[model samples]
Target: MEEVEIEPLGADEARDILAVAQDRRNGTRWSVALALGLRQCEALGLRWKYVDLKRGTIRVFWQIKHQRYRHGCKDPHACGERLHRYPCPKDCPKARRTSGRKHVCIKEGQKFCAPDCTKHAPSCPERVGGWTFVKPKGKSKRTVMIPPPLIPLLKQHQEAQQAERQAAGEAWQDYGLVWCHTDGRPIDAGQDWDEWKELLRLADVDKDARVHDARHTAATLLIEQGVDISVVQGILGHSQLTTTKRYTHITATLSNEAAARMGRALWG
Candidate 1:
Protein backbone atom coordinates (compact mmCIF):
# COMPACT_ATOMS: atom_id res chain seq x y z
CA MET A 1 0.00 0.00 0.00
CA GLU A 2 1.20 3.51 -0.73
CA GLU A 3 1.94 5.78 2.23
CA VAL A 4 -0.77 8.27 3.15
CA GLU A 5 0.42 11.78 3.88
CA ILE A 6 -1.54 14.17 6.09
CA GLU A 7 -1.11 17.80 5.05
CA PRO A 8 -3.41 20.29 6.71
CA LEU A 9 -4.70 23.21 4.76
CA GLY A 10 -3.89 26.69 5.95
CA ALA A 11 -6.62 28.66 7.71
CA ASP A 12 -7.31 30.60 4.54
CA GLU A 13 -7.81 27.36 2.62
CA ALA A 14 -10.12 25.93 5.26
CA ARG A 15 -12.14 29.12 5.13
CA ASP A 16 -12.35 28.80 1.36
CA ILE A 17 -13.52 25.20 1.63
CA LEU A 18 -16.20 26.05 4.18
CA ALA A 19 -17.40 28.95 2.08
CA VAL A 20 -17.78 26.74 -0.97
CA ALA A 21 -19.68 23.96 0.79
CA GLN A 22 -22.98 25.85 0.91
CA ASP A 23 -25.26 22.92 1.68
CA ARG A 24 -26.18 22.76 5.35
CA ARG A 25 -25.49 19.02 5.69
CA ASN A 26 -22.15 19.30 3.91
CA GLY A 27 -21.12 22.32 5.92
CA THR A 28 -21.97 20.59 9.16
CA ARG A 29 -19.83 17.61 8.17
CA TRP A 30 -16.90 19.88 7.38
CA SER A 31 -17.39 21.75 10.64
CA VAL A 32 -17.43 18.49 12.57
CA ALA A 33 -14.34 17.27 10.75
CA LEU A 34 -12.49 20.49 11.58
CA ALA A 35 -13.69 20.46 15.15
CA LEU A 36 -13.26 16.86 16.25
CA GLY A 37 -10.45 15.83 13.92
CA LEU A 38 -12.46 12.69 13.18
CA ARG A 39 -11.59 10.18 10.48
CA GLN A 40 -14.08 9.95 7.65
CA CYS A 41 -15.70 6.81 9.04
CA GLU A 42 -15.76 8.04 12.61
CA ALA A 43 -17.64 11.13 11.47
CA LEU A 44 -19.97 9.08 9.26
CA GLY A 45 -20.62 6.48 11.94
CA LEU A 46 -21.51 9.21 14.44
CA ARG A 47 -25.09 8.58 15.60
CA TRP A 48 -27.66 10.93 17.08
CA LYS A 49 -27.22 9.41 20.53
CA TYR A 50 -23.52 10.23 20.67
CA VAL A 51 -23.69 13.98 20.14
CA ASP A 52 -24.42 16.23 23.10
CA LEU A 53 -25.19 19.51 21.38
CA LYS A 54 -26.10 21.07 24.67
CA ARG A 55 -22.66 20.25 26.06
CA GLY A 56 -20.84 20.78 22.76
CA THR A 57 -19.32 17.29 22.77
CA ILE A 58 -19.53 14.38 20.32
CA ARG A 59 -19.32 10.78 21.50
CA VAL A 60 -18.41 8.05 19.00
CA PHE A 61 -19.94 4.68 19.82
CA TRP A 62 -19.81 2.02 17.09
CA GLN A 63 -18.72 1.61 13.49
CA ILE A 64 -20.64 0.11 10.57
CA LYS A 65 -18.73 -2.34 8.39
CA HIS A 66 -19.67 -3.31 4.83
CA GLN A 67 -21.25 -6.43 6.29
CA ARG A 68 -21.96 -4.77 9.62
CA TYR A 69 -24.34 -7.38 10.99
CA ARG A 70 -23.50 -10.23 8.64
CA HIS A 71 -23.22 -13.26 10.83
CA GLY A 72 -21.14 -16.39 10.24
CA CYS A 73 -18.91 -18.90 12.01
CA LYS A 74 -16.25 -16.81 13.82
CA ASP A 75 -14.24 -19.68 15.34
CA PRO A 76 -11.07 -20.54 13.45
CA HIS A 77 -11.59 -24.25 13.92
CA ALA A 78 -15.17 -24.20 12.68
CA CYS A 79 -16.23 -24.71 9.07
CA GLY A 80 -15.29 -21.82 6.81
CA GLU A 81 -18.86 -20.92 6.03
CA ARG A 82 -20.29 -17.56 7.07
CA LEU A 83 -23.17 -17.83 9.55
CA HIS A 84 -25.59 -15.45 11.17
CA ARG A 85 -25.07 -14.26 14.71
CA TYR A 86 -27.39 -16.94 16.04
CA PRO A 87 -25.34 -19.73 14.47
CA CYS A 88 -21.93 -18.33 15.41
CA PRO A 89 -19.75 -20.27 17.84
CA LYS A 90 -20.14 -17.52 20.45
CA ASP A 91 -23.88 -18.11 20.56
CA CYS A 92 -23.61 -21.89 20.47
CA PRO A 93 -23.98 -23.84 23.72
CA LYS A 94 -20.78 -25.78 23.01
CA ALA A 95 -18.70 -22.57 22.83
CA ARG A 96 -17.21 -21.25 26.05
CA ARG A 97 -18.38 -17.81 27.07
CA THR A 98 -15.19 -16.01 28.03
CA SER A 99 -16.18 -12.59 29.42
CA GLY A 100 -18.46 -9.64 28.60
CA ARG A 101 -21.97 -8.39 28.97
CA LYS A 102 -24.65 -10.69 27.63
CA HIS A 103 -26.91 -7.71 27.25
CA VAL A 104 -30.09 -8.35 25.33
CA CYS A 105 -29.05 -10.60 22.49
CA ILE A 106 -31.96 -12.23 20.71
CA LYS A 107 -30.98 -13.91 17.47
CA GLU A 108 -33.77 -15.21 15.25
CA GLY A 109 -36.40 -16.56 17.68
CA GLN A 110 -34.04 -17.74 20.40
CA LYS A 111 -32.76 -15.60 23.28
CA PHE A 112 -28.98 -15.26 23.36
CA CYS A 113 -28.52 -13.10 26.45
CA ALA A 114 -29.90 -10.16 28.40
CA PRO A 115 -29.94 -6.75 26.77
CA ASP A 116 -27.64 -5.30 29.46
CA CYS A 117 -24.97 -7.97 29.12
CA THR A 118 -21.32 -7.10 29.97
CA LYS A 119 -17.98 -8.82 29.38
CA HIS A 120 -18.05 -10.74 32.66
CA ALA A 121 -20.53 -13.40 31.58
CA PRO A 122 -19.17 -16.99 31.68
CA SER A 123 -20.41 -17.61 28.12
CA CYS A 124 -20.07 -14.27 26.41
CA PRO A 125 -22.34 -14.16 23.43
CA GLU A 126 -21.45 -10.71 22.18
CA ARG A 127 -18.51 -10.41 19.83
CA VAL A 128 -15.48 -8.63 21.20
CA GLY A 129 -15.66 -4.87 20.71
CA GLY A 130 -13.03 -3.17 18.55
CA TRP A 131 -12.13 0.38 17.65
CA THR A 132 -15.16 2.43 16.66
CA PHE A 133 -13.53 4.37 13.80
CA VAL A 134 -13.25 2.84 10.29
CA LYS A 135 -11.47 3.77 7.06
CA PRO A 136 -13.07 3.61 3.63
CA LYS A 137 -10.36 1.73 1.67
CA GLY A 138 -6.88 3.26 1.87
CA LYS A 139 -7.26 5.54 4.90
CA SER A 140 -6.70 4.88 8.60
CA LYS A 141 -8.91 5.86 11.52
CA ARG A 142 -7.77 8.67 13.79
CA THR A 143 -9.76 10.05 16.78
CA VAL A 144 -9.08 13.68 17.63
CA MET A 145 -11.01 16.29 19.63
CA ILE A 146 -12.60 19.55 18.61
CA PRO A 147 -10.59 22.68 19.24
CA PRO A 148 -11.72 25.23 21.84
CA PRO A 149 -12.13 28.03 19.30
CA LEU A 150 -14.55 25.92 17.28
CA ILE A 151 -16.76 25.26 20.28
CA PRO A 152 -18.80 28.42 19.75
CA LEU A 153 -19.14 27.73 16.05
CA LEU A 154 -20.36 24.22 16.81
CA LYS A 155 -22.91 25.63 19.23
CA GLN A 156 -24.18 28.09 16.66
CA HIS A 157 -24.21 25.37 14.02
CA GLN A 158 -26.26 23.13 16.31
CA GLU A 159 -28.81 25.86 16.75
CA ALA A 160 -29.10 26.32 13.00
CA GLN A 161 -29.48 22.56 12.52
CA GLN A 162 -32.22 22.44 15.13
CA ALA A 163 -34.10 25.23 13.37
CA GLU A 164 -33.83 23.38 10.07
CA ARG A 165 -35.12 20.20 11.67
CA GLN A 166 -38.08 22.04 13.18
CA ALA A 167 -38.96 23.55 9.80
CA ALA A 168 -39.31 20.04 8.35
CA GLY A 169 -42.63 19.56 10.17
CA GLU A 170 -43.52 16.13 11.65
CA ALA A 171 -41.08 14.08 9.59
CA TRP A 172 -38.16 14.88 11.83
CA GLN A 173 -36.93 12.37 14.37
CA ASP A 174 -36.80 13.99 17.78
CA TYR A 175 -33.41 13.52 19.40
CA GLY A 176 -33.88 16.89 21.09
CA LEU A 177 -30.84 18.99 20.15
CA VAL A 178 -28.70 16.76 18.02
CA TRP A 179 -27.21 18.42 14.91
CA CYS A 180 -28.51 15.80 12.50
CA HIS A 181 -31.27 15.45 9.95
CA THR A 182 -34.91 15.95 10.77
CA ASP A 183 -35.28 12.16 10.73
CA GLY A 184 -32.49 11.85 13.33
CA ARG A 185 -30.21 9.93 10.99
CA PRO A 186 -26.48 10.34 11.33
CA ILE A 187 -24.86 12.24 8.45
CA ASP A 188 -23.09 9.95 5.97
CA ALA A 189 -19.40 10.91 6.17
CA GLY A 190 -18.39 9.72 2.72
CA GLN A 191 -21.10 11.69 1.00
CA ASP A 192 -20.25 14.56 3.26
CA TRP A 193 -16.58 14.41 2.15
CA ASP A 194 -17.48 14.43 -1.51
CA GLU A 195 -19.69 17.44 -1.03
CA TRP A 196 -17.00 19.17 1.02
CA LYS A 197 -14.36 18.59 -1.63
CA GLU A 198 -16.63 20.11 -4.24
CA LEU A 199 -17.20 23.03 -1.95
CA LEU A 200 -13.47 23.56 -1.54
CA ARG A 201 -13.08 23.72 -5.28
CA LEU A 202 -15.88 26.23 -5.46
CA ALA A 203 -14.23 28.31 -2.74
CA ASP A 204 -11.11 28.54 -4.96
CA VAL A 205 -8.98 26.30 -2.74
CA ASP A 206 -6.95 23.31 -3.79
CA LYS A 207 -9.22 20.26 -4.02
CA ASP A 208 -6.25 17.96 -3.63
CA ALA A 209 -6.20 18.40 0.16
CA ARG A 210 -7.42 15.25 1.88
CA VAL A 211 -10.02 15.54 4.62
CA HIS A 212 -7.70 13.75 7.05
CA ASP A 213 -5.37 16.74 6.92
CA ALA A 214 -7.96 18.85 8.71
CA ARG A 215 -7.23 16.72 11.74
CA HIS A 216 -3.51 17.35 11.36
CA THR A 217 -4.27 21.05 11.07
CA ALA A 218 -6.27 20.99 14.27
CA ALA A 219 -3.41 19.30 16.12
CA THR A 220 -0.78 21.58 14.60
CA LEU A 221 -2.75 24.71 15.48
CA LEU A 222 -3.17 23.65 19.08
CA ILE A 223 0.51 22.90 19.48
CA GLU A 224 1.46 26.18 17.82
CA GLN A 225 -0.73 27.98 20.31
CA GLY A 226 1.40 26.66 23.15
CA VAL A 227 -1.13 24.11 24.38
CA ASP A 228 0.50 21.31 26.34
CA ILE A 229 1.46 18.21 24.40
CA SER A 230 -0.33 15.91 26.85
CA VAL A 231 -3.54 17.90 26.51
CA VAL A 232 -3.29 17.69 22.74
CA GLN A 233 -2.86 13.94 23.05
CA GLY A 234 -6.04 13.72 25.10
CA ILE A 235 -7.95 15.92 22.68
CA LEU A 236 -6.67 13.91 19.72
CA GLY A 237 -7.46 10.63 21.56
CA HIS A 238 -4.06 9.23 20.65
CA SER A 239 -3.28 6.05 22.61
CA GLN A 240 0.38 6.98 22.97
CA LEU A 241 2.64 10.04 23.29
CA THR A 242 4.85 9.00 20.41
CA THR A 243 1.93 9.44 18.04
CA THR A 244 1.58 13.05 19.24
CA LYS A 245 5.30 13.87 19.18
CA ARG A 246 5.08 14.63 15.47
CA TYR A 247 3.75 18.07 16.39
CA THR A 248 6.49 18.84 18.89
CA HIS A 249 8.15 20.96 16.25
CA ILE A 250 5.34 23.43 16.75
CA THR A 251 6.49 23.85 20.32
CA ALA A 252 9.90 24.83 19.00
CA THR A 253 8.24 27.25 16.62
CA LEU A 254 6.42 28.89 19.52
CA SER A 255 9.64 29.07 21.51
CA ASN A 256 11.32 30.85 18.63
CA GLU A 257 8.49 33.37 18.54
CA ALA A 258 8.87 33.95 22.27
CA ALA A 259 12.62 34.50 21.89
CA ALA A 260 12.00 37.01 19.13
CA ARG A 261 9.70 38.96 21.44
CA MET A 262 12.32 38.92 24.17
CA GLY A 263 15.00 40.16 21.80
CA ARG A 264 12.82 43.08 20.71
CA ALA A 265 12.19 44.02 24.36
CA LEU A 266 15.82 43.79 25.41
CA TRP A 267 17.48 45.49 22.39
CA GLY A 268 14.83 47.94 21.23
Candidate 2:
Protein backbone atom coordinates (compact mmCIF):
# COMPACT_ATOMS: atom_id res chain seq x y z
CA MET A 1 0.00 0.00 0.00
CA GLU A 2 1.18 3.54 -0.69
CA GLU A 3 2.35 5.46 2.34
CA VAL A 4 0.09 8.26 3.48
CA GLU A 5 1.34 11.34 5.33
CA ILE A 6 -0.80 11.92 8.41
CA GLU A 7 -0.54 15.45 9.76
CA PRO A 8 -2.80 16.04 12.76
CA LEU A 9 -3.26 19.30 14.59
CA GLY A 10 -1.80 19.75 18.06
CA ALA A 11 -4.21 20.08 21.01
CA ASP A 12 -3.69 23.83 21.11
CA GLU A 13 -4.24 24.13 17.36
CA ALA A 14 -7.44 22.11 17.57
CA ARG A 15 -8.63 24.41 20.36
CA ASP A 16 -7.89 27.50 18.30
CA ILE A 17 -9.78 26.12 15.31
CA LEU A 18 -12.81 25.23 17.41
CA ALA A 19 -12.78 28.59 19.18
CA VAL A 20 -12.77 30.44 15.86
CA ALA A 21 -15.45 28.20 14.37
CA GLN A 22 -17.79 28.73 17.34
CA ASP A 23 -18.72 32.22 16.12
CA ARG A 24 -19.47 31.22 12.53
CA ARG A 25 -22.61 29.67 11.05
CA ASN A 26 -22.60 25.85 11.07
CA GLY A 27 -19.50 26.15 13.22
CA THR A 28 -20.47 23.16 15.30
CA ARG A 29 -20.11 21.09 12.16
CA TRP A 30 -16.30 21.49 12.26
CA SER A 31 -16.27 20.72 15.99
CA VAL A 32 -18.13 17.45 15.34
CA ALA A 33 -15.54 16.45 12.73
CA LEU A 34 -12.58 17.21 15.01
CA ALA A 35 -14.18 15.70 18.12
CA LEU A 36 -16.03 12.70 16.68
CA GLY A 37 -14.04 11.93 13.51
CA LEU A 38 -17.02 11.98 11.17
CA ARG A 39 -16.26 11.74 7.43
CA GLN A 40 -17.31 14.65 5.27
CA CYS A 41 -20.19 12.68 3.79
CA GLU A 42 -21.33 11.51 7.22
CA ALA A 43 -21.24 15.05 8.59
CA LEU A 44 -23.16 16.42 5.59
CA GLY A 45 -25.77 13.66 5.79
CA LEU A 46 -26.31 14.01 9.53
CA ARG A 47 -29.95 14.87 10.19
CA TRP A 48 -31.48 16.45 13.23
CA LYS A 49 -33.65 13.36 13.67
CA TYR A 50 -30.59 11.13 14.10
CA VAL A 51 -29.02 13.42 16.70
CA ASP A 52 -30.32 12.65 20.20
CA LEU A 53 -29.24 15.65 22.23
CA LYS A 54 -31.08 14.32 25.26
CA ARG A 55 -29.15 11.05 25.08
CA GLY A 56 -25.90 12.75 24.08
CA THR A 57 -25.41 10.50 21.06
CA ILE A 58 -25.53 10.70 17.26
CA ARG A 59 -26.62 7.79 15.04
CA VAL A 60 -24.48 7.81 11.93
CA PHE A 61 -26.56 5.83 9.48
CA TRP A 62 -26.35 7.81 6.25
CA GLN A 63 -23.93 9.75 4.06
CA ILE A 64 -24.44 12.27 1.30
CA LYS A 65 -22.87 11.33 -2.06
CA HIS A 66 -22.91 12.71 -5.55
CA GLN A 67 -23.60 9.88 -7.95
CA ARG A 68 -22.36 10.16 -11.53
CA TYR A 69 -24.92 10.61 -14.29
CA ARG A 70 -25.91 7.69 -16.50
CA HIS A 71 -27.52 7.61 -19.90
CA GLY A 72 -31.15 7.08 -19.03
CA CYS A 73 -32.53 7.76 -22.49
CA LYS A 74 -33.64 4.78 -24.57
CA ASP A 75 -31.09 5.48 -27.30
CA PRO A 76 -28.00 7.21 -26.00
CA HIS A 77 -26.74 7.85 -29.52
CA ALA A 78 -30.09 9.20 -30.74
CA CYS A 79 -30.81 11.21 -27.61
CA GLY A 80 -29.90 14.34 -29.51
CA GLU A 81 -28.37 15.24 -32.90
CA ARG A 82 -25.29 16.65 -31.22
CA LEU A 83 -25.08 13.92 -28.58
CA HIS A 84 -23.93 11.10 -30.93
CA ARG A 85 -20.23 10.20 -30.68
CA TYR A 86 -18.40 9.71 -33.99
CA PRO A 87 -15.27 7.68 -34.76
CA CYS A 88 -11.95 9.52 -35.25
CA PRO A 89 -10.77 10.38 -38.72
CA LYS A 90 -9.00 7.42 -40.34
CA ASP A 91 -5.63 9.23 -40.72
CA CYS A 92 -5.84 11.44 -37.67
CA PRO A 93 -2.53 11.35 -35.75
CA LYS A 94 -4.27 12.08 -32.43
CA ALA A 95 -6.57 9.02 -32.62
CA ARG A 96 -5.99 6.54 -29.81
CA ARG A 97 -7.51 3.11 -29.19
CA THR A 98 -10.49 3.28 -26.84
CA SER A 99 -11.24 -0.46 -27.17
CA GLY A 100 -10.13 -3.42 -29.31
CA ARG A 101 -10.33 -1.67 -32.71
CA LYS A 102 -12.04 1.65 -32.14
CA HIS A 103 -10.13 4.87 -31.70
CA VAL A 104 -11.12 8.43 -30.85
CA CYS A 105 -9.58 11.88 -31.03
CA ILE A 106 -8.04 13.65 -28.04
CA LYS A 107 -10.54 15.14 -25.62
CA GLU A 108 -9.66 18.72 -26.62
CA GLY A 109 -9.40 18.04 -30.35
CA GLN A 110 -12.14 19.81 -32.30
CA LYS A 111 -11.66 18.00 -35.62
CA PHE A 112 -12.81 14.59 -34.33
CA CYS A 113 -15.39 13.71 -31.69
CA ALA A 114 -14.50 12.05 -28.37
CA PRO A 115 -16.51 9.41 -26.53
CA ASP A 116 -19.78 10.77 -25.15
CA CYS A 117 -19.45 13.48 -27.81
CA THR A 118 -21.22 16.60 -26.62
CA LYS A 119 -23.67 14.63 -24.51
CA HIS A 120 -24.87 16.66 -21.56
CA ALA A 121 -26.14 14.20 -18.98
CA PRO A 122 -27.40 16.88 -16.65
CA SER A 123 -29.68 18.23 -19.39
CA CYS A 124 -31.14 14.79 -20.11
CA PRO A 125 -34.85 14.64 -19.41
CA GLU A 126 -34.47 11.26 -17.65
CA ARG A 127 -31.03 11.75 -16.13
CA VAL A 128 -30.49 9.40 -13.19
CA GLY A 129 -27.76 10.92 -11.10
CA GLY A 130 -27.28 13.75 -8.59
CA TRP A 131 -26.71 14.28 -4.92
CA THR A 132 -28.55 11.80 -2.67
CA PHE A 133 -28.36 10.34 0.81
CA VAL A 134 -27.45 6.68 1.20
CA LYS A 135 -26.61 4.28 4.01
CA PRO A 136 -22.96 4.29 5.11
CA LYS A 137 -20.92 1.08 4.79
CA GLY A 138 -21.69 -1.45 7.54
CA LYS A 139 -18.64 -0.58 9.63
CA SER A 140 -19.06 3.19 9.14
CA LYS A 141 -22.60 2.96 10.44
CA ARG A 142 -22.08 3.37 14.19
CA THR A 143 -23.28 5.59 16.98
CA VAL A 144 -21.00 8.34 18.34
CA MET A 145 -21.22 9.70 21.85
CA ILE A 146 -21.31 13.47 22.16
CA PRO A 147 -18.36 14.92 24.07
CA PRO A 148 -19.30 16.95 27.19
CA PRO A 149 -17.75 20.12 25.81
CA LEU A 150 -19.67 19.68 22.53
CA ILE A 151 -23.14 19.37 24.06
CA PRO A 152 -23.53 23.08 24.78
CA LEU A 153 -22.15 23.96 21.37
CA LEU A 154 -24.76 21.73 19.75
CA LYS A 155 -27.55 23.39 21.75
CA GLN A 156 -26.34 26.81 20.72
CA HIS A 157 -26.22 25.63 17.11
CA GLN A 158 -29.83 24.48 17.38
CA GLU A 159 -30.93 27.91 18.60
CA ALA A 160 -29.09 29.56 15.72
CA GLN A 161 -30.70 27.19 13.24
CA GLN A 162 -34.13 27.93 14.67
CA ALA A 163 -33.55 31.62 14.16
CA GLU A 164 -32.44 30.99 10.58
CA ARG A 165 -35.56 28.88 9.96
CA GLN A 166 -37.80 31.67 11.19
CA ALA A 167 -36.05 34.20 8.99
CA ALA A 168 -36.27 31.96 5.93
CA GLY A 169 -40.02 31.44 6.60
CA GLU A 170 -41.69 29.93 3.52
CA ALA A 171 -38.39 29.83 1.58
CA TRP A 172 -36.91 27.04 3.68
CA GLN A 173 -36.68 23.59 2.06
CA ASP A 174 -36.62 21.71 5.40
CA TYR A 175 -34.24 18.85 4.54
CA GLY A 176 -33.75 18.34 8.31
CA LEU A 177 -29.92 18.32 8.01
CA VAL A 178 -28.06 19.46 11.14
CA TRP A 179 -25.81 21.61 8.95
CA CYS A 180 -27.40 23.16 5.88
CA HIS A 181 -27.81 26.36 3.93
CA THR A 182 -29.87 29.20 5.36
CA ASP A 183 -32.77 27.97 3.19
CA GLY A 184 -32.50 24.52 4.83
CA ARG A 185 -31.24 22.79 1.69
CA PRO A 186 -28.23 20.52 1.98
CA ILE A 187 -24.90 22.33 1.63
CA ASP A 188 -22.98 21.32 -1.49
CA ALA A 189 -19.67 19.54 -0.87
CA GLY A 190 -17.68 22.18 -2.75
CA GLN A 191 -19.22 24.93 -0.66
CA ASP A 192 -18.53 22.98 2.50
CA TRP A 193 -14.84 22.60 1.49
CA ASP A 194 -14.56 26.32 0.79
CA GLU A 195 -16.01 27.06 4.19
CA TRP A 196 -13.48 24.77 5.86
CA LYS A 197 -10.62 26.58 4.12
CA GLU A 198 -11.99 29.89 5.39
CA LEU A 199 -12.24 28.43 8.92
CA LEU A 200 -8.57 27.37 8.80
CA ARG A 201 -7.59 30.87 7.68
CA LEU A 202 -9.59 32.46 10.49
CA ALA A 203 -8.13 30.07 13.08
CA ASP A 204 -4.57 30.76 11.91
CA VAL A 205 -4.01 27.03 11.63
CA ASP A 206 -2.33 25.16 8.78
CA LYS A 207 -3.86 26.63 5.64
CA ASP A 208 -2.87 23.55 3.62
CA ALA A 209 -4.65 21.14 5.97
CA ARG A 210 -7.53 19.34 4.35
CA VAL A 211 -10.97 19.00 5.90
CA HIS A 212 -10.35 15.24 6.26
CA ASP A 213 -7.40 16.07 8.54
CA ALA A 214 -9.93 16.70 11.27
CA ARG A 215 -10.48 12.95 11.44
CA HIS A 216 -6.74 12.37 11.75
CA THR A 217 -6.55 15.04 14.44
CA ALA A 218 -9.34 13.37 16.39
CA ALA A 219 -7.62 9.98 16.24
CA THR A 220 -4.27 11.45 17.32
CA LEU A 221 -5.90 13.36 20.19
CA LEU A 222 -7.68 10.25 21.48
CA ILE A 223 -4.48 8.20 21.38
CA GLU A 224 -2.53 11.01 23.10
CA GLN A 225 -5.06 10.94 25.95
CA GLY A 226 -4.05 7.30 26.60
CA VAL A 227 -7.33 5.94 25.26
CA ASP A 228 -6.94 2.28 24.33
CA ILE A 229 -6.24 1.68 20.64
CA SER A 230 -9.22 -0.66 20.32
CA VAL A 231 -11.50 1.97 21.88
CA VAL A 232 -10.21 4.58 19.44
CA GLN A 233 -10.87 2.18 16.58
CA GLY A 234 -14.48 1.80 17.68
CA ILE A 235 -14.94 5.54 18.14
CA LEU A 236 -13.59 6.10 14.62
CA GLY A 237 -15.87 3.35 13.24
CA HIS A 238 -12.94 1.82 11.34
CA SER A 239 -13.49 -1.76 10.25
CA GLN A 240 -9.88 -2.64 11.12
CA LEU A 241 -7.36 -1.66 13.78
CA THR A 242 -4.85 -0.99 10.99
CA THR A 243 -7.08 1.71 9.55
CA THR A 244 -7.27 3.48 12.90
CA LYS A 245 -3.51 3.24 13.30
CA ARG A 246 -3.06 4.82 9.90
CA TYR A 247 -5.06 7.83 11.04
CA THR A 248 -3.21 8.16 14.37
CA HIS A 249 -0.03 10.23 14.23
CA ILE A 250 2.40 9.53 17.05
CA THR A 251 4.12 12.77 18.03
CA ALA A 252 7.33 13.34 20.03
CA THR A 253 5.39 14.02 23.23
CA LEU A 254 3.58 10.70 22.97
CA SER A 255 6.86 8.92 22.27
CA ASN A 256 8.57 10.50 25.28
CA GLU A 257 5.61 9.61 27.52
CA ALA A 258 5.80 6.01 26.32
CA ALA A 259 9.53 5.86 27.07
CA ALA A 260 8.98 7.27 30.59
CA ARG A 261 6.27 4.71 31.36
CA MET A 262 8.49 1.88 30.16
CA GLY A 263 11.44 3.13 32.26
CA ARG A 264 9.25 3.42 35.38
CA ALA A 265 7.85 -0.08 34.89
CA LEU A 266 11.31 -1.61 34.49
CA TRP A 267 13.25 0.43 37.13
CA GLY A 268 10.64 0.58 39.90
Best by lDDT: 2
Clashing pairs in 2: none
Q: List per-candidate RMSD values in Å.
A: 13.2, 8.6
Cα lDDT tens digits for candidate 1, 63-104: 443333221334422221122223344545544456653433
Name the runs in model 1 displaced over 4 angstroms: 1-4, 61-64, 68-189, 250-259, 265-268
Model 1, residue 128: C-alpha shift (Å): 16
Over 4 Å off, model 2? 1-3, 69-127, 247-249, 262-268
Least well predicted 10-residue stretch by lDDT in candidate 2: 109-118
The Cα local distance difference test for each model comes to 0.57, 0.82
- Residue range 1-268, candidate 2, lDDT tens digits: 2127777888898999889888889999999999988988999989999999999999999998889887688755455535444566777776655656776444464543343454667666788887788997858888889998899889999999999999999999887999999989888889989998888898898648887888888888988888888888888888878877764446776888888999999996
Instruction: Give all TM-scores, in the order shown.
Output: 0.56, 0.77
